[model samples]
Target: MSKEQIKLRSMIITALFAAIIGVMAQLTIPLPLVPITGQTLAIGLAATILGARYGTLSVLLYIAIGSIGVPVFAEFSAGLSVLVGPTGGFLIGFIPATFIIGLFLEKLGFTFKNAIIANIIGMLITLAFGTVWLKIATDLSWVSALASGFTPFLVVGTIKAILASWIGIIVRKRLLSAKLLISNDIKQSA
Candidate 1:
């Protein structure tokens, strides 16, 4: 592909992942403190497939759309308030987590083991940011913040990370074979 074609393809793929993230966000299991959502799975998939730059851009676009009143968050909720709310940190954390995961996949090569490690690290990043934000947002104690924000989601998050890694690697391999994603597309941009 020509340079322009490559750029256009990258843009399209990034937008596609952004939409996927938005759609996944709607699959929420509401809880008293924090809701469980498929957002993290989508994040992992995007990062693994799109690499750091495009994946991070996709996540940022998702957040921007939601911040602008698009009903793309959990339970179809949106707007700036949703971001500043108790769960906002988790949403914000997706950006860095996606970037890190993508970076790992890009640098280490896309393998199941690498994907698992990357996803786990990404999950931890999200949890740490979310826990602190939850404490501040809810004025809860540190232990309370961990319990409400971190504990409840541990098992589910681990499962999601593992599943996302497997799914992402499979999808990425298929995309590569089909030429929908070039090998260079998965490389980290300087």
Candidate 2:
């Protein structure tokens, strides 16, 4: 493929992942504060499959669409209000979380072990960001924030982390084998 074709392919995949994130965001187990959604899992999948730069791009695209009132966030919430809402930090945290997940995979190779570690770290980062913002936004005590935002998600997050790791590695390897994803360090697929 030419340079333009490669760029276009990557762009399409990035946008597709953004849409996937939106779709996954709808899968929510509602809680009082921040609900558990498939977003973090999708983020992990994006990172594992797309690598650092493009994975971050996918997340940025997802956030951008949601910020523009696309209703792409958890529970179909959207707009700048959602971005600055109590759970906004979690959305913003996705940027770093996605980047770090892909970065770790890029550095350590896209193995199940490394993906698990990366996803676990990413999950904690999201929880921390959301918990702090929840406290500040809701004027709750740190204890309350932890109770509602952080503590509630631990078990589910670990489960999602493992799933993201296992599924991500499998999909990534298949895509690589199929030449659908960019191979090695020379370029990115999406």
Candidate 3:
């Protein structure tokens, strides 16, 4: 493919993942503090498939769209308020989390084991950021922040990470085999 074609393909893929994240954000289990959502799963999948730069771009795109008052967040929330809300840290954390996950996958090779480890680490990063922000945003104690934002999501996050690892690996291999995505694209973007 030409350089322009490759760039266009990458852009399309990034946008697609952004939309996927937005849709996944709606699959929420509302909680008093932070809602549990399928966003983490989508983040893992995007990182695993798109690699670091593009995967992070996808998340940034999602945040940008949501910040523009689009109903793309959990419970159809949007705009600057959502970004500055208590749970916003988790949403912002998605960028770094996805980048780290994609970096590990790219460096270590796109295997099931790597994906799981990367996703686990990414989840921890997200939790840490979210917990701290929850404390700051809500004026709660650190312990309370962790209790409400971190502890509640541990089990679900682990399950989602594992599932995302398996699904992402399978999807990546299939796409690679079908010539829809080039291996170099992943390696180069790392």
Candidate 4:
């Protein structure tokens, strides 16, 4: 395939994966305070497989789609209102969270250990943003924000982070192998 064709294919695949992440956000595990969603998993997967630029773009695309009343968010919520709501910080945090995660992925490369570290750092960034936003939106202090958002998900977040990180590494390796095969076939045909 030509270079342009390859680029186009990559963009399409990235968009598809972004859509998948959006869909995955709707599948939530209900909890007492805030429901846990599979969003971080999608974020990690997108960053790992698509690289930093494309991964961040895919997340931006997801937010854009959701903003336009797509019912893509948790519990089928949508629009700018949701963006500015109490949970809006977490929703908006997706942007920097994905970017930070992808940045770590780019700098650290694809290793299981590095992947785990990347997820931890990435989740920390998200928690920071979410906590700050929660505080402002709900008129609570930092301690309260952390109590509600970060503390509840500590154990489960660690597990999901590990799972997502490993999955991302495996997916990235598979994608690399497939790309090499495609490149070799193109060369042979040429």
Candidate 5:
């Protein structure tokens, strides 16, 4: 395969990963205010596998598509209405979560310690943004917002982080190996 072929394959894979994230977002455990889903896990996987730039871009594209009337959000909600709705903060946090996680993945190479710490930090960032937005939108205090918006997500979020981190490291390694193998083949052919 040539360079162009590699680029094309990467782009396609990234898009498919993003699409998987979108579909995962729809598998919600219904909550009163913000539904819980496996979307964050997908975000973490994308960041760890795709690195900062493309990972962030993939997440942003997912948000954009869901915000523009695509039925990609939890519970099938879509459009600008969902973007500005009460759960919007969590939606927005996806960008930073993926970006920051990818940063750690790139810099620290996803060792067990780094994966644990990075996942914690990334999730904290997501919670911060989500709670702040929830408070502002609902006229709740910080504690109340956290109680309502972030607390319920605690257990499941932790589990997702652990699972995603483990899976992400493996997936990243595999993808990197595939990339190297493809490059070596192309070089030999050339």
Candidate 6:
């Protein structure tokens, strides 16, 4: 395919991943402070499959849409208020988390092992951002924030990380084979 074709395809795929993130955000196990959602899983998938540039782009797109009052966040929440709410840090953190995950895989190659490592790191990044933000946003003590926003997610986040890595690599390979994805690396820029 020509450069324009490839770019168009990549844009479409990136937008699709953004939609996927929104859909996944709806999968929530609600908590008092912050719910457990599949948003992180979709973030991992985007990073592993689309790499940094487009992965980050997908995250930005998701946030932009949600900020515009679309019900795309966890529990179908949205708008600028949601972004600035207690959970906002986690939402904002998805940007760096997705970028780092994709950048790690892009540099290290899209192996399952690498994806796992990257996803784990990304998960931690999200949790850290969320925890800190939760503490400040809610005026909770650090201990409370950890309990509410961080501790509860460790095991679940690990599981989701593994799932994202495994499934992402599988789907990424298939996409590449089908020429929907550019290559094994998927390092194309938007």
- Residue 40 in candidate 5 has what lDDT? 83
lDDT of candidate 3 vs native? 0.90
Off by over 4 Å in 2: 186-190
The candidate that wins on lDDT is 6
lDDT of 3 by residue, 1-190 (tens): 8889878888998999999999999999989989999999999999988888889999999999999999999988999899899999999899899999998988888988888999999999999889988899999998899999999999999999999889998888887887677667434321
Candidate 2 residues 96-181, lDDT tens each?
99999888888777888888999999999989998888999999998999999899889999999999989988998888888787
lDDT at residue 52 of model 4 (Cα atoms): 66
Q: How many residue pairs clash in model 4?
A: 0
What TM-score number comes out for model 1?
Answer: 0.96
Per-residue lDDT, model 6, residue 15, is 95
What does candidate 6 score on TM? 0.96
- Candidate 3 Cα outliers beyond 4 Å, as residue runs: 185-190
Taking the tens digit of each residue's C-alpha lDDT, what string does model 5 give over 1-190?
Answer: 7779878876787688779888888788888777888788888777766767777888888888888888888877789888777788888998898889877766766565566667777777788788888998888988889888899888888888888778877776676666631222111110
Inter-residue clash pairs, candidate 1: none
Give per-model TM-scores. Answer: 0.96, 0.96, 0.96, 0.89, 0.89, 0.96
Q: Which regions of candidate 4 fall more than 4 Å away from where they truly are?
A: 180-190
**Model 1, stretches more than 4 Å misplaced?**
185-190
Q: What is the C-alpha lDDT profile of model 6 across 1-190, one tens digit per residue?
A: 9999999998999999999999999999988889999999999999988888999999999999999999999999999999889999999999999999998988878888888999999999999998998899999999999999999999999999999999998898888878887854534322
RMSD (Cα, Å) of model 1: 2.5
Candidate 6: which stretches are off by over 4 Å? 184-190
In angstroms, the error of model 6 at 161 is 0.3
As for candidate 4, its clashing pairs are none
